[model samples]
Target: MRLTRRDAIAVLAGLGVVGGGAVAVDQFDPPTAETAETGETGDGGGDGALSATVTATMTAAAAVVYPSQTEGVADFVETYVVGRARDESRRDAMRDAALELDAIARDWYGDDFADLSADDRDSLLRELGVAAADPVADGTVSERIRFHVVNELLYAFYASPTGGRLVGIENPIGHAGGTESYQRATMLEDDAGRVERAERAGDAEDVEGSEADE
Candidate 1:
């Protein structure tokens, strides 16, 4: 389920989002200015707000569902769900249906779902897998947010530098080095040919320069 950085983002974009442990419990200090700028280059929008009530509920159930959320789950849902609700393209009826998805949490556990204990959170999210997949609910705020959260967990593991190295997934960028023993031969051949051609061209230029000097 791990995904390289590109793959993780692509997966998140495709899922429209998934649970992120980072969003709920991870309280990772926001990246420094430079790193935040880097994260923003590809992700168009950023964080949003949530109340203490909503946050506590999401910590258990929602955080497990999404996994790497840290303390930002509320922000994510606000952007993707409420923002979408406001847009003209989003239907009022569908928005209402989406809101209803949270009923399960309120009715089953009481309070906002986020406030539950870790064990409760784990229990709730595990239960959600079967329920969230139901298309009717999946499109709503409840599962819709969870869907994104799940991707975040997968992304964190896969996008990590060591994660990529562990899985033998090559960086599409082709600059990062790989384990020597496991190197792909085709990679070396292609690089060698490119280097050889560049060297030959450099030598030709050097000869031409020398002749001119003479």
Candidate 2:
């Protein structure tokens, strides 16, 4: 199945990453720095952690991290990020990672991280050595980026139904199919009941025959 961004967002909503992807998608107005500073908005957190810079940075990262076929990358990442940033600590870490990423981008490419070309962004992440680093919330720049940015996005995707399916997990832990999942179990239960009834009937017939013989 081609993994669409909507599918990923559904999975995130099911996992409570965002309250509701549908609402977030339709009602989402990109937060400006002025609005964020005034604390007038943002479903993400009261502390205004879901800044425009962070949203843009993460969306750009998703374009690189997600499989090429995934659609609506920007919307999907923004929704997931807003929900994730609700936590004060997590929000702070994400903001820090975004700033650090931009700093690195300006140094190497003379641009913000989100403004870099896809190839350059990918190259920059590789240059930071995140693939080999141990993810640590309070570690070095590379480690923090790995923990808060790269690995964070990866974990959210893989844990969701869309990404989990790639690895042969039809129903990942968080996404239960409700009645659909119970269909097989229900069939087995009915079959067992029929077998028990047949056995009881046979036992009664044997007793009747034995009594008649005696």
Best-performing candidate as measured by TM-score: 2
lDDT, model 1, position 149:
41
Candidate 1 structure quality by residue, lDDT tens digits, 44-107: 1322222233323333343554445334444333333321222223223333332333456677
Query: What local distance difference test score does each model get?
Result: 0.36, 0.61
| Alpha-carbon lDDT of model 2 | 0.61
Q: Residue 200's C-alpha lDDT in candidate 2? A: 34
List runs of model 1 lying over 4 Å from the truth. Answer: 1-103, 131-146, 162-214
lDDT of 1 at 4: 21
Model 2 off-target regions past 4 Å? 1-50, 174-214
lDDT of 2 by residue, 76-105 (tens): 566566556545577778877877887889
C-alpha lDDT of residue 111 in model 2: 95
